[model samples]
Target: MAKRALSVLVSGYTFLEGLRWHEDRLWASDFYTGKVIAAGLDGRVTEMAQVPQQPSGLGWLPDGRLLISSMRDRKVLRREPDGTLAVHADLTALTGGHINDMVVDRAGRAYVGNFGFDLMSGAPFRTTGLVCVEPDGAARVVAEGLWFPNGSFITPDGRTLIVNETFGNRVSAFDILPGGNLGPRRDWASFGAMPDSDDIGTLMAAASIAPDGGALDAEGAVWVADAIGKRIVRVQQGGRILEQIDTGEQGIFAAALGGPRGTTLFMAAAPNFAEHERRATRLGQILMAEVDVPHAGLP
Candidate 1:
């Protein structure tokens, strides 16, 4: 059964990802356009910054400067108060693949993830590490051996970090130590055992859900965009689906709960995930729905 139909909040984007609700607006990165934008419910859109190599994830520092993931260049760019972009953290030597999504705590500690392997080139799957960039701009690997870590969230108390392992068929969690280092990992939500195949097609087929970008609700539940299921689903801690919104033809890549009342659920959708295919058209859209719970946790 469907909870509700998704209405188009905004459309004509190349491909939207890493969306967040901040300061009464929706912020996101357009992969192909290389532009990080912010949109309001009134249909107004603003360009925040541009990353030449491309932008995927977004966050904010304690001083209010914006941080964006420069995917291809393997770097995190910071937008200064003057609106100029500068290098905040150089991850070229710390990561193996193109940098992907990121989550930043109140103290400005950023945990960024990567692809682990080349999917566009059809390369075999490889495990990767998660890099934690400190408030001083220093970076190091806090955890490793992850299978395509994507969306992430820091508990309001800043004690636990939960990350979705897209190809692992589970959401892994860790304790956020005093210095931002992570403790041993545990399965916060497991759809099934981790897939053992190296082929992307085989792994996708064996998994129950490929969780992508997501948002945490005030009730401690997460709304995850199911890349394999082509829908938006609310997930509990133990892999239970609390609510689901089916998208007949659109493929969702990101989710966010925002708006005046904080009940508006925003979803980023497209026809497909093919980079080349999306670059040729602006069919990507931001879909909106309503939920009972408001948002909580860090970006």
Candidate 2:
């Protein structure tokens, strides 16, 4: 496939976290600001709802409600039609670490993850894998001992689930069993070694490589937000980097494929996370690129 260049859609955000395509709007989250926003196809940004804690992931329920992962509270939330957010499930007791990103199935079952360790303090904590949450608020740990799971996506056939191991520098695959439980874990893709950095501790660059989020394309390729590399990479199913689109910024937290034709690749980028803390800059922004391939599964 031919490589394409990235284009800036808009700029000036606090800290872009999640990117999703729902209905005619592109939904996203600003973790630092605790705000979930909906951007129109015409580039109009509007506030959808605000959560008390950091919103990490976005999903839709069978009833058409919005499902969100509240990172700080370690819970999954549902936003009703009246714009009220309610706790759908509390995962504190099920997960050994803080919840991160998630993916929900058509059956309304959500697969959630934990940091496994503290990211900000560069400290080692507990290791928790993946958990499956039902609509009724029941949860079960389906996988374990993953190194900081981040972005995740289920295959169109609903037979496989792929998860990005942020700190581990790899993507893992599992069988989607009955009732939305994950089967045995297997390595899907692995980045050999992490880049060395003095400022970011002995942290593996591979872990933070695809830090925040990513999406799957129509050709069965995984489009990952390579934060450390300041680019978005399209990886084939067999683990080859097919294309790379540079962001020209530091922190590229998340991405999605949306637009009128569903071929527009939307990237959520920002300067270094530390920069947001310094001046409270609206540094986070959403950028777009017209790719030849369209997004495969739900955005």
**Residues forming the 10-long window of minimal summed lDDT in candidate 1:** 1-10
Segments in model 2 whose C-alpha atoms lie over 4 Å from true places = 1-5, 193-200, 205-208, 275-279
Candidate 2 structure quality by residue, lDDT tens digits, 210-244: 54589888888888887577888888765688888
Instruction: Give per-model CA RMSD.
Output: 1.0, 2.7
Local accuracy by lDDT, each model: 0.90, 0.78
| True-structure lDDT of candidate 2 | 0.78
Clashing pairs in 1: none
Residue 258 of candidate 2: its Cα lDDT? 76
Give per-residue CA lDDT, model 1, range 1-299, as digits (tens).
54685688789999999998889899999999998999999869999998889899899999998999999999999999999999999998999899999999999989999997888888999989899998778999999988899999998888999998888888899999988999998989999975578899999999889999999988889998988888988999998999888898898998888899888999999988888899999999999998889988887
| TM-score, one value per model | 0.98, 0.91
What stretches of model 1 exceed 4 Å from their correct place? none
